[model samples]
Target: MARMISYCMRIIEIPMLYLQKRLGISRLAWVFLLPNLLLFGLFAFLPVVLNFVYAMTGSDQILLQDRTFVGMGNYQTLTSCEDFLNPNSCKDDLFWRAVYNTFWFVLLQVGFMVGFALLTALMLNSKIRARGFFRSVFFFPVLLSPVVVALIWKWILQREGLANAALEGMGFDTINWLLDRHWAFFWSVFISVWAHMGFYTLILLAGLQAIPRDVYEAASMDAASPFRTFRRITLPLLMPTMIVVLVLSLIKSVQTFDEVYAFTGGGPGSATTLLIQYVYETGFAGTPRLFGLASAASILLAVVLVILTCLQLWASRRNVNG
Candidate 1:
C-alpha cells in the first residue's frame, strides 16, 4: 500500500515536473496553485454565491431548482413590522429577540471581557513570582475546545452542580443557574468571557511588552505616580492595540454560537439565543426549513461584519494619521 501510494504520488508529480521544465516559473506556480484555487472556488465562493441566490428566492424546498424567485420578499418579510423598537410587535419576533440578545451580549460581554483581560494582562506583564506559570494558567482555557469548555461550565452551573453544592455548603440558598432567564444569560456571558479572555489578555500583554522601558524610566525620573504613568504613557501608547482588540472582540461577540449553543442550547425559553443560533435553527433545525429567511439573516450578518471591518480600518487609519 505504501509503495502503491508512493507510485501514485510520483505519477501525479511527473506531469507537474514536466510542466515546470517546459513552462516558466510563473506558469508553473499557477500549476501548483490550481488545486487550492479550485477548492476555494468550490467551497467558499460557491457557497457565498449560492447563499445570495437562495436569499433572493422564497423556498420551503432545499434545492435551488425547486425554489421560487421572490426578488426582495424574504428581506421584506424580515423587515416587516409595526414597531421596530419593540421586538415583540415585529412580525418575526424571534429574529428581533435574537438581535436584542446579541446586542446586549456584545455590549456586556465585550465590556467585561476587555476590562478583565486588560487587568489580567497588566498583572501578567508586571514583575511577579511564577509569571510564566500564571501566564500559562490564564491562557490554558483558550486552548480548550469550545465544546469541552461549554460542557465543563455547564456541569458546574447545573442545578445540582458544583456551584449550587458550594452554595449549600456555605449555608446559602442554592440558586438555579441554568433554568432562570437572567441567570442563564448571566452565565452565558460570564462563561464566554472566561473562555476567551486569555486570548485578548495575551494580545494586550504583547502590546504592553512592546512599550519602551525608557518611557517608564523617564516617567519615574519625573516623579510620576504609577496611576499617572499608566494614564498618560501606557494607555495613550496602547490605544491602537486596544482598538484592534476591541474591534476583534466585538466581531467575535456578534458571531458567538458554539459555546453558547453547547452550554445553554439557547434555552430557558430562548433567553440566550443569539442571531447565529437563530439563523441555524431557522435554516436546519425545524421540520420546515426556512432557507431563504436564514440566508437573508446570514446576509444581514455579513453586512454587519463588513461594516465593522470598515470601521476598524477607518479607526486604524485615523490613528495612523493622528
Candidate 2:
C-alpha cells in the first residue's frame, strides 16, 4: 500500500511541479485552496443562484422550466397588508404571524441565551472544585443531536412523563406544558437555551482566559471591589467576544427550526411557528406548495442574516483597527 501510494504521489508531483513553476510561490495559496473553492462554488454559490431563480418563478411544479415567471409578485404578496399591526389583515397572515413569532423568539432566545452563557462562562472561569468536570457537564448537551435533545426534552415535558410524575409526587398539579400556547412558546425558548448555551459559554470562557492575570492583580492592589473590577476591566476586554456571541446567537435564533419541529411541531395553532417553518410548509408540505412565496420568504430571511453577518464583520474590523 505504501509503495502504491508513493507511485501515485510521484505521478501527481510531475504536474504539480510544472504548475508551481508556471504560477510561482507567490500564487501557491490559490493552488492550495483551489479544491475547497471549487467545492464551495458548486455547493454554496450554485444553490444560492438556484434559490433566487425559484423566488422569481411561480408554480407547484418541481421543474424550473415549467414554472412561470412572476417577477416581484411573491414579494408583493408577502409584504402587502391592510393593517401591518394586525396579521389577520394581511393577505399572507401566516407569514406575518411567523414573522411576529420569529421577532419575539430572536429577542428572547438571543437575550436569554447570551446572558446564561456569560454567567456560566464567568463561573467556569473562576477557581472552583471539579471545574473541569463541571465544564464538561455544561457542554455535554451541545454534543447531542438536536433530534435527540428534543425527544429527551419532550419525554421530560410530556403529561405522563418524568416531569409531571415529579410534580404529582411533590403535591403540585401536572400542568399540560405543550398544550398551552404561552407555555409552548416558553418551552421552545427554554429548550433551545438549555441545549445550546454551552457552546457560547465555551466561546466566552476562552475570551475570559485570554485576559491577563496581572491586570486583575493590579485591580486587587488598588482595592477594587469584585463588581467594580468586572465592570471596569473584564467587560471592556470581553466586548469583542460578546459582540461575536450576540450576532451568532441572533442569527441562530432567527433560523431555529429542527429542534422546534421535533419538540412542539409548531403546535397549539402555530403558537411556536417560526419563519423557517412557515417557509418549509409553504414550499413543500402545504396543500398548494407555493414554491415562489416560500423562496421569497427565505430570500428575505437571507437578507436579514447577511445584514447581521456584515455587522459582525464591521465590528471585528473596527476592534482589530483599534
Candidate 3:
C-alpha cells in the first residue's frame, strides 16, 4: 500500500513539475481551478442565465432558440387576477393555490420545528438515563434520505397501517389518513418536523451547553426556579442559536419538495402543492409543459430565497459578533 501510494504520488509530481514550469507557480493555481470553474459556470451560472431567458420567452418548446420572446408575459399571467386571495379568480389558479399553501406550510413547519427542537434540546440537556443514546436516536432520522422519510411516514399513515390499526384497536373505524386534505397537510408538516427536528435540536443543545455552568450555579444559589432560570438565562443566551435555526428552517420549508412530494404527491386535490412542486409540474410533469411560466415561478421563488439568505447572513454575522 505504501509503495502504491509512492508510485501514485511520483506520477502526480511529474505533471505538477511540468505544469509549474509552463504556467509559473502563482498562475498554476488557476489550472487546478479551471475544471471546477467550468463546471460551476455550466451547471450553476448558465442555468440562472437561461432561467431568466426562459422567463422572457413563450411557447412549450424546450429549446431556447425555438421559444419566442414574450417579454414579461409569463410574469403578467401569474400576477393577472381579479381577486388575489381567491385562487379560482386567477389566470393561473394553480400558481396562486401553490403560493398560499407554501405560505401556510412555511409558517406551520418553521414554528413547530423550532419549538419542538428547543424543547427536545432542553430535555436532553437535563441529567437523564441514556442521554447519549437518546440523542443518537433523535438524530438518526436526519440521516435518512428525504424520500425514505416520506415513504416511512406514508406507509405508517396509510389506511391499513399502524395509525389506522391503532384507531381501530380502540373501536374507532379505520379511515384513510393521507386522503383527507386537512389530515394530509397536518401529516406533511408533522413529518417534515420529525425528520429535521433533531438537527436543530443538536444546534440548540450545543448553545445550551455553552451557557456557563457558573451562571446556572449563581441562579441556583438565588433559588431560581427552573422556569425562572430558563426565562432569564437559558432563553436569552439561546436566542442567537434560535435565530439561526429559524432562518435555516424557514428556507428549507420554503424550498420543500422531495419528501413532501413523495409523501403526498401534492395531493388531496392539490391541497399540499408548494411553489417548488408547482415549478416542477409546470416545467416537466404537465402536458404542454410551460417552461416560460415555470421559469417565472422559479425566479419568484429565488427572490424569496434570496431574502431568506440575507436574513441568514445577518443572523450568522450577529451570532459571530456576540
TM-scores, all candidates, are 0.89, 0.90, 0.91
Evaluated at residue 13, the lDDT of candidate 2 is 96
Which segments of model 2 are wrong by more than 4 Å? 1-38
Stretches off by above 4 angstroms in model 3 are: 1-32
Clashing pairs in 3: none
User: On lDDT, who's better, 2 or 3?
Assistant: 3
Rate residue 202 of model 3 by lDDT. Answer: 99
Decreasing lDDT order of the candidates = 3, 2, 1
Question: Which candidate tops lDDT?
Answer: 3
Better of 1 and 3 by lDDT: 3
TM-score: which is higher, 1 or 2? Answer: 2
lDDT of each: 0.93, 0.93, 0.96
Candidate 3: tens digits of C-alpha lDDT, residues 1-322: 9999999999999999999999899999999999999999999999999999999999999988899999999999999999999999999999999999999999999999999999999999999999999999999999999999999999899988989999989999988889999999999999999999999999999999999999999999999999999999999999999999999999989999999999999998999999999999999999999999999999999999999999999999999999
Task: Say which prediction, candidate 1 or candidate 3, comes out ahead on TM-score.
Answer: 3
